[model samples]
Target chain A: MSLSITVVVVTTSTALHAADKLIASATAAGFDVRVVARTGDDPIADVVKVAIAASSSEYVSIIESDGWLSGEAGAVIGGFLASHPGADIVYTDEGTVGRRGRIDVIAKPIFSPERLRCQFYWGDIVLYRRSLFDEVGGVDASVPGAELYDLALRASIAARSVEHIAKPLFIRSVQSDSGLGGIALESTRRALERHLASTGGGVVRAVGADGVHDTRRLVQGEPLISIVIPSRGIYSEIDGERRCYVVDAARSIMDLSTYQNFEITLVLDSVAESEVISELMAIVGQKLRIVEWTKPFNFSEKINHGVLHSRGEFVLLLNDDVQILEPEWLESLLALAQRPGAGMSGGMLYYKDDTIQHAGHGYYDGDASHIGLDAPRTDPGPLNGYRVEREVSGVTAACAMMPKALFIEVGGLSNLLPGNFNDVDLCMKVTWLGHDIYWTPHAELYHFESKTRDASVHAFEVDVAWGRWGFRMHDPRYWPYPHNRPPA
Target chain B: MTEITPDEQADYERDARQLALVDRIIGLEAQVAHLRSVNTSQALRDQLKEVKSSTTWKVGRLVLAPALALQRLLGRNADKDK
Candidate 1:
């Protein structure tokens, strides 16, 4: 099938040479190319509007001058469009061309509206259906440096379907400033605020050096959040002092959390000391409920029993070894979980030694592992991955929150694999039911798990997980570029 | 917003320092692990070089040269026939 696509090259006076080369490359690749020269006076959105208006192609792509299309881009895009006729907005993976060669490849995730609101992760080159573009009113000239971001946000909300081409079809110059700062930062903030205002009321706060913003949605009412923590109620020495783990966890929630409309359901083993239970009672007061687990040591069963005893609109599965760092951590997770189509939301967890424990779960090569394990908190990850909220394949149930109704709908956690990969199984069920799981960096917690890592992966659990959800290995949400591909 | 007390501020500062120290230690450990692997690889390369320069290895290669050449010739002929 023949697919006519118009490539609108948005260029500045300084990059006219690059613009010409890009146009030549696009033309060679059998795409209609148009140049929109920006004299640094008129808004870029206005020039792009004119260029798009002059085009008669069914599909239109907007790219910066310093970006070049790959040799197979036209054929790949045409094939994809032919296959997915309902795709309204399409984007591809991109890489940076340095003096040495092509370096720093960015294999972007499938269209994530949450990630887009945090940062402009959908590189410079994006193909939009002309009808969808016109429906979203092209672009907002008032957004200045963030016109494309604003357009993407508007188009994503209005588009019928958004598709991601995994092939790296766009190559950008390394010298181009993709970092958020100055006017781009201000424009991003404005765009995000506008997006929030239109979707739902939320406050945007810029976090991290990479211009990642946190959108705190204003929940309409105070829905009770039930925090389910399964623990042995054992004592651990922290900072040279012996403290009951459950009591410390309870105390941290009571003292540090800003959200008050919540309850704590401690699913403790029956062997737990009475003194520890009394101390937890003292700390949590009337907001705490103890569910004694008489069964074998099964984390899944403990959580399921905890959920059965609790009554709340939302349920948060938290480990007893965790200490809340952020005051509004509960609110942060709830805001994302409360959003439409959001299945589960997890927080950024740090080890006791401060390296990352879990950013999100990434499934690759038939194995599920933490996306950014042991990476320093200062590292924002590729394209500010760790600093922004985005859809993930799964999240560690150590601190995952979801609506109670949705949790029950997915049959809670699987009891077959009671220990390991149970959270992954639960998340897979959630996504299988067509809901997106989100991981947010805004909610910070220190997971003081034992120093000796639980390196045991039972063959039984692996077989069960692999048998049920083997298709997850093909889902590339967090894994980027070369890492996403299976081995030869 | 809840106001943070002086004690909480002190605790945060201490935790921050500890975190920085832990990060540095982890980085150093990674560097050490990388260096150890590089050293091991270099040792293996040197051993291979020594074996390649040995008289026995040279004699073996010289003896196998005719056989290898004949195998390649036969493979090319088979490919052409196919």
Candidate 2:
């Protein structure tokens, strides 16, 4: 028989427009649609639990009143279930219905446990197997806002295969000020805390809120960070004068930085002047160290050597061309790196002209594309999501932070991807190792933008990346919508 | 009116020389900055070699002189219009 599914439509009586549409869609899709209505302080969990108990179907598709499934979703889901009977939870790509009935598609990547811990990239409309749902306790009434997230976590913990439908199967109306309120925020916080506690024994602390929410998992004590810079002492003309990029970057860290528990390591291909070295030492005091790289200009090798020489617990790979914009940038990045599933944390970088350089990166075709590539400083691209702390496929190593142990474990960047793709390769390796890669807008920096490297290496590196980890790059979590720029 | 003594004249000359040396250093530093920007990586060098040998690149190179003149003329005119 066709895989039976009960559409658990949750909603209020006042907003019956959305519920009616969803019911119609479900009915047309040949699913036994069950509408669950709750009003006045009734928790989502209670409603969901009641619905699950009443449903006689094999699977329960959770959909909010405002959320509707695509015409093909029922068939696609049934097909997926028939193919993979073991999968307990299945989610699909979702779209936000905009004004004039335009749908902005949010293309999602396949399952990544690390991505889930950082941000809720997966949509709300998920088909849960009734058997597994019952086994893991259908839902917690206490956790209302993040009940779905909590369930996903529990299901994942139970070692349930959570499959993703690449095609968009759900659509929901985009609402303004629809951000998490007090209760919702609390629920989310509790959900994240429980997830962190269950996965890794650590103290979860909420960092930022409102539009850009951050919950950092602080592990034990204050971990030392080693800021490594690989450079050839290349000089750049800023304003009208010449300054060594490496020296300037070091000076910025020493003068403007607020992160006290960090050391700076300069990995160089050639010996800098004694005066320059002395000046750097004087500026950084005892926090400065220089390591000579005696071979070709291999960024991966330089970083590896720098890590070998570093004494800190975490290694921050930094380019010599970037300058610190925020005093708490390091602190923010460190917090993300200390998260339960995070293997790498990167910062939002701005060009010298104040345009957004790197807000996070999404891989498309064979190359890594920046999120807010050339948008103005405040332009929040499409959905105001560009300026938020979220899990990304990969982040540039221009300001990447990771645990030194994790870096070592992943073999400290690939030598094959010497010049380019090294950062992407490293991030992908971390993801492969069952850890997340995070890109935070909080940790801001001014990247002078590739003053030391050549782009020609990118072509060869792209070949190498395609050869080694090509499939992973396709269909990144950060979907490249046509409207990548901010709405007018 | 100020420098009548030989020692004062010598000091003035010394200061002038120092200033000249500083200027020269600044000039050299600027040149180095320009050179650094123009400097190519090993991969870029390989690409450049391939381009240099290519007939298309060679033909493009031949058209460069006129293109530069035309670009300069257009730029000046556009600036004037602005």
Candidate 3:
């Protein structure tokens, strides 16, 4: 029988005192453990190697001295392995104890080539097969503020696929002075630069670092826009026909917009009722061209399919229920998103009472999940805004637009997030690429329609969110996590 | 004798004197109307007794506070420039 677990405690003189509780927790969990410290010997790589070498168990996980493993973590991993013999690695979403204890995740979109460099890995509650770590040669502490990031990057590139247990298995707490944030940023930039050079793409060119202030000036001449809507039998609720939204949407677009340089494409999946299709076709005049697919209801796959069929430079992933608030929203959103590192942009969300649903996007700390964009609005300014844009850790899929190139680079959206929250994962992955995700007050939409609530959280939604969150670290950038936007 | 016939001069002087008398009567009539508006009979009865005694009721701080003390206190604090 394989040894149950090898808990490797990584310590440094700087924060060794911080790890006392975490070390004790590992011991209490009945882990056959190794506590290793590096005085001047490069702590990270040394610990990862020692942890891998000492383990005889089928599983291995690196526990930073400052991180606490959940009491039930050992049992959860043990059962997961028993169930998934072919699994190479199993990770859990971790909650960190920082200024406050918060849980954050690695989003799904990060599975793409953007993480090819050692710097792009963010959340570090890792549990892996010891053989794989040995094959990849474990962590390299020489990267300076980006040690484990390099190790995880090599493993992700080497692995067949990574599996997640969707539980809070590891607790990475915050100490007075943790280098996680600065290190994570360095890791991501290195990854992007590597991926681009490897694929013959040049280093990120400088354009509007100031901002693409006017969308028209940025990508002038209305580059084509393909609007995609996923349809179910919930037709009337979404609108008259899936097409009526397309029509009213087109009419609303035409009526609200002063600019005339655009076209609309509607992605119609096989809704069971003929009336749904007929209703859509009758209402959508020359304004919309419809595309039909018989594929099952996988939201990400459907979006991926829509992306391939589209010929536009920008693709707006929109829900059917939204009504136009600013007629020129496309121009404004396109303007902001058109900037150099801007990966995606979303409109403000409102409840029927004109209260805020979301400003752009906010994050979840372990205590709670899925906080809104500008919850209970404060002084109108970015606290640590990277640039002029209020840089959020992530954005939601409800009404977000992206440049096609960046979308493709992040591997479109994740097919695994069948019902919900694939967008948040995509948002984190793109932002990690040194790109900014902007939430615009100018681009506004109201979600009075509640079909989205059906998947507000299914079991898989919870599981995917928990698993995807396996990568995002809890830091000040997402501080006000578990916070709400001041209702508008 | 040529500059003015006695009867004509007398009529002219009488007309000038009558015009001056009419102007004086109009001025007196306006002053009486102002006094009538300000002087309520009931209030004046009490003030008259005080004024007769020279104990109250005054217009300016220069003197006469003894004649209209209450009236001076009740006067509006409005500025005179406007």
TM-score, every prediction: 0.81, 0.73, 0.43
Give me the overall lDDT of model 1: 0.79
Error of 1 at A52 (Å): 2.5
Q: Write the per-residue lDDT of candidate 2 for residues A1-488, one digit (tens) a residue.
A: 34588877777777767578788888877777767676755578777777777768877777664677787877887788889888878888888787798887867656756446655666767777888888888877877766776777777777568888877788887772256667767777787778877876434455234433454444356778999988876555766987877787888888887778889888766655666666677777888777766677777777877776678999999998888888878877887788777798998999887888887767766456677777889887644556556677778888999998887767676665677777877776678678888777878889987423346656677666655566555545554443244211
Give one digit per residue, the lDDT tens place, for model 3 in A366-484.
Answer: 32233343333332322212112344566667678888777766666766566676786677567656787765565766655542344445777555554445435343343343454
Candidate 1 docking category? incorrect
User: Can you tell me the DockQ of model 2?
Assistant: 0.01
DockQ winner between candidates 1 and 3: 1
Interface RMSD of each: 16.5, 22.5, 51.3
Regions of candidate 1 where Cα sits further than 4 Å from its true position? A1-3, A178-181, A207-211, A236-241, A478-488, B1-82
DockQ comparison, 2 vs 3, better candidate: 2
Q: Would candidate 2 be rated incorrect, acceptable, medium or high by CAPRI criteria?
A: incorrect
Better of 2 and 3 by lDDT: 2
Error of 3 at A326 (Å): 0.3
List the candidates ranked by TM-score, beginning with the highest: 1, 2, 3
Candidate 1 C-alpha lDDT tens digits along A1-488: 33588988888877688677688778877888888877654568777888888889998888774778887888888888889999899998887886568456778888887787887777777889999999888978777766788889889999989889988888877776555546666777788888989887788876333556776676658999999999998776777998887787788899999999999988888788878988888899889888777779878768876776678899999999889999999988998898889899999999888888888888876667777777787877777788888888888999999998877666677666678988887887788778988888989999987546674778988776766676455567655522322211
| Candidate that scores best on lDDT | 1
Order of models, best lDDT first = 1, 2, 3
Per-residue lDDT tens digits for candidate 1, residues B1-82, read 1134678647644643443353334334434544554567788899999999999999999999999999999999999999
